[model samples]
Target: MHQVHVVGLGVDHRDITPTASRLIDSAEVLAGGDRLLALFNDHPAVKILIKSPLKNVIDRINQEMQSHRKVVVLADGDPLFFGIGKRLIDAFGKDAVIIYPNVTTLQVAASKLKIPWHDIKSISLHGRKDIQPLLTALVGNNRVAVFTEPDFSPAKVADELIRRGADTFNMHVFEDLETETEKTRCFELKDAVKQTFSPLNFIILNRIKQAVISLSLGLDDDLYLHQRGLITKREIRVAGLSSLEIEPHHTLWDLGAGCGSVAIEASLLAYEGIVLAVEKAPERIQLIRQNISRMCAYGVEVIHGEMPECLESLPDPHRVFIGGGMGKDNSVLEAATERLRPGGKLVLHLVLMGSMARARDYLKDLKWPFSITQLQVSRSKDLAGDHRLEALNPVFIISAKKPALRL
Candidate 1:
């Protein structure tokens, strides 16, 4: 039969059966990672598998199947659990393939640790969205399992989770699941910072919820998504929402879309107004996408790269929110304010002393019809089982109009 077979292998070649070994040895071509391919070292003509350049491998597989040659593709743990088998079946179709099962590492991990596998909430965060959604699903006291990648490995996840103030969950990490050198590491959610982990590791988190910082106002500053160390305060966020002036068919620009607060809110406001949230960081770009999706702000479009460069292709603006120029030198706010049609509103926030000065002089030069505001916010806190008050940093705001900017 002209077909492809995807075979799963155990941690070691010794675990493979004679029939599977024979299929590997007699295959016309082999495709997989360096280690997986090396498992069949005796077969000298194995073709290497490269994921990004996927079409090349597909082309070879197609050619082999057309020639009626037997092809065996190798995969790790389970071919169906975050493995390549499903992609093969999807690409080549079910009628053209057969899958030989092997024990997935999770089974081995559970067996080795004597724990139940079905109870753990298994997720692959390799290229999945950040742990925010995963965090939201967390129960007060529960367990979570995650598969890791080189970039978003176990350590990185723990660091991010802790930063987001995940001091409520306990973590259990296991590495090299079924190998001779396998390892498992455990820690409480708050004590996670006490240790780090290896690159190849899986995570299990036990819920460890912290005290509610007055619920509504204290969105757990750690929970809001932002870049390298930048975020919008809830107070400023509420204010920006006020000035968005969103309406049906309105198109808004959230320049320096820190945590996508304005964009998400504008999307909520305009429901029909379009919000373009712009940011320069790759992580924050992804974060904005996740936040928009999480809030189901489908009307909001998350653009990658920097604002002006990223925004060059977007249609004209109806309203713009400048949240980052607080300290930026080559500011996109200038372009946004300039492009704002007659009567269109351009709302801006400046944080740095010098940036505020620069903004004052620049706005004065424009001499547009505008209104300026400064906010000194005080947030309530709890101390000694009583409510206390505290203040966040001060901010300067300006809302200008180009006088017929549009509906």
Candidate 2:
């Protein structure tokens, strides 16, 4: 059966395979975004439109398929590297499509760096507002590769990392991969921050022993200056952290930041991720700041404000911990329920049933998937030569996730 053919194109049209080029030039129906279309603008006898809203592209493919004309789908950088190829193939039968390949930006960057990609950590920051964490990852591993964005150029990334906390990694930027206009630079973040260049750039990051995860959150107490009675207890803090389902580079929010232990731990998860410590008390805010500093949680941000409000200003988080600011601030349960990314987790620690009821109700209203846990911890007390058990406090934790919404 004659069906649509999917093609992956490189920046230079000359890179197109002879068969792929012949298919594109002969395709009665051409489909792709402006960049891909303009890439072959001089080719005769075809129509094109800018891809937008994503759904439109899907519809266009469906439309061409009905007409039974040859349709060619074009993409760049492995299309599968955060590209549209997978979705298109998923919608149209894979057997009905043909994909031509080319060198991806990641491949070019690694080749120029003389580093094996398997040994490097990779991240794509296209259209993404953050790339700071990728810089931090360099401190633990060598040979990092990233697809960069315009505003968060290599310079901005270098500056933010060293400015925030990625001093240990060596950095490099590769421009116009695979072309004569290609260029590469290797230097420290401090030096890289001072320089600037073209938008067609990817980064290579390298780091040393700094990759060790700091599990000693206690020693960090001296570092952060937070408010009294506002922080999560180090003992109980593990519960919230565990429920977060955290990974390196996953964003987290400590809505009632308190002393910011959760946010600090979240930051420690990695620099590619964000940890927002939201609190209203100046004392706790100071403590949060100090904790972030002492703990070396460079990616953690301390915001002086209450939950829900402070949480609202940040991007949709991957995980959330409600350690303080419960009461009316339980509104975080509402806001979080709305902004919760698919599979994102929200965990709340409270001794009071009031907060638990609120969380339960909110999750029910949203029809989100959730689980609840109650923990009772006891302390050991000395009585003469005998030891007695004393209960510290019981905590109720509620964790919930919104179903993943996808194209």
Candidate 3:
């Protein structure tokens, strides 16, 4: 059987190489999206228009291949870079296909802007409902490039950035790249939010200004929007996170997340991981979202329902933090423990002795390795002409680890 040839068209028709031209000219059957196929309208090969329900297209390609026809698939840029080449390789193993590489849109965008793309984080917003990747990239990288889908435009991206208070970056929107009608424009997020562009566009975000909100592990309380006395103290948050022993890919849950302080900070530690902030109170849920944006705490999902019942729908956590949701009943604690993955860690913050006792007993029953830490934090206060240490409420942190599965 003849292997399928997947050719990348670079950024323009002129950019197609001699080798790729030879493959396209020799193909008995050609397959690609409408735009790519239009470039070769005069070609003699049978054209298969690639469209949604791509499974049909794959099946058709398979049928052609079985008939011993030479199939050529045209793709934009380097197909392996967020393009159809990977899907083809997955559909038919690597040995069954040959990919001809070319310059990607990211490379062209970088060249046009005269910026090095070596470190720029790239994500595609195509067919995506959540902008979590955008948010996450903005938090960690100085520059980000997005492959914009028709439905998820630059304006929508701007709106989300502005909403998250992560609008400190300058936006660059490239429309109809490499075509005769190609256009490039740059704007502040505020201005970008009000404008629209071609459906065929790419976005690059450059960090021009520092975020107004400070982002760090155990961020200052004043940086977050929360009701007075509702946020976790900075020191307690630090201690709790330390006890959770979060790894880069661990999924951590903040049960009864108040303004998402612990979860937001945990996101930094679990940078390549998932963090969920579960809050029951409507007002606090809003606050959690605001803090998530302000803090640039990407990947922290705000769950807006009560504990125990709400935790059921969530992915099992590798680390769990119980800050506020436990009532007189131990259902919340029980649920979190039951849902925790083996070798996972759970940490709880309590000011009340009764609550501490309940958590202690719960861990003891599970016979998990556990430890307690007493934290007494104080900040300096100006008394008259000088400063004095004003003590905050004492907090008890309980740390427990679920036993690993024995081999």
Local lDDT at 85 for model 3: 92
Error of 1 at 337 (Å): 15
Top-lDDT candidate index = 3
- Off by more than 4 A, model 1: 127-141, 189-199, 210-407
lDDT of 2: 0.70
**Which pairs clash in the backbone of model 3?**
none
Tens-place lDDT digits, model 3, residues 58-173: 99999999999999999988889998998888999999989999999999999999999999999988767768777777778889999988767999889877766676689999
Write one digit per residue (lDDT tens) for candidate 1, span 163-226: 5445556777787665687788777655655565666567776555543322232244465556
Best by TM-score: 3
Poorest 10 consecutive residues by lDDT, candidate 2:
211-220
Segments of candidate 3 deviating more than 4 angstroms: 41-67, 90-95, 219-230, 249-251, 280-294, 298-318, 334-345, 360-407
The clash count of every prediction, one per candidate, is 15, 15, 0
TM-score of each: 0.52, 0.71, 0.80
- In model 3, the Cα lDDT at residue 260 comes to 91
lDDT of 2 by residue, 65-172 (tens): 787877887778576666777787787768876677777767767666665676667777766666655634543454567767777888888877765555656777
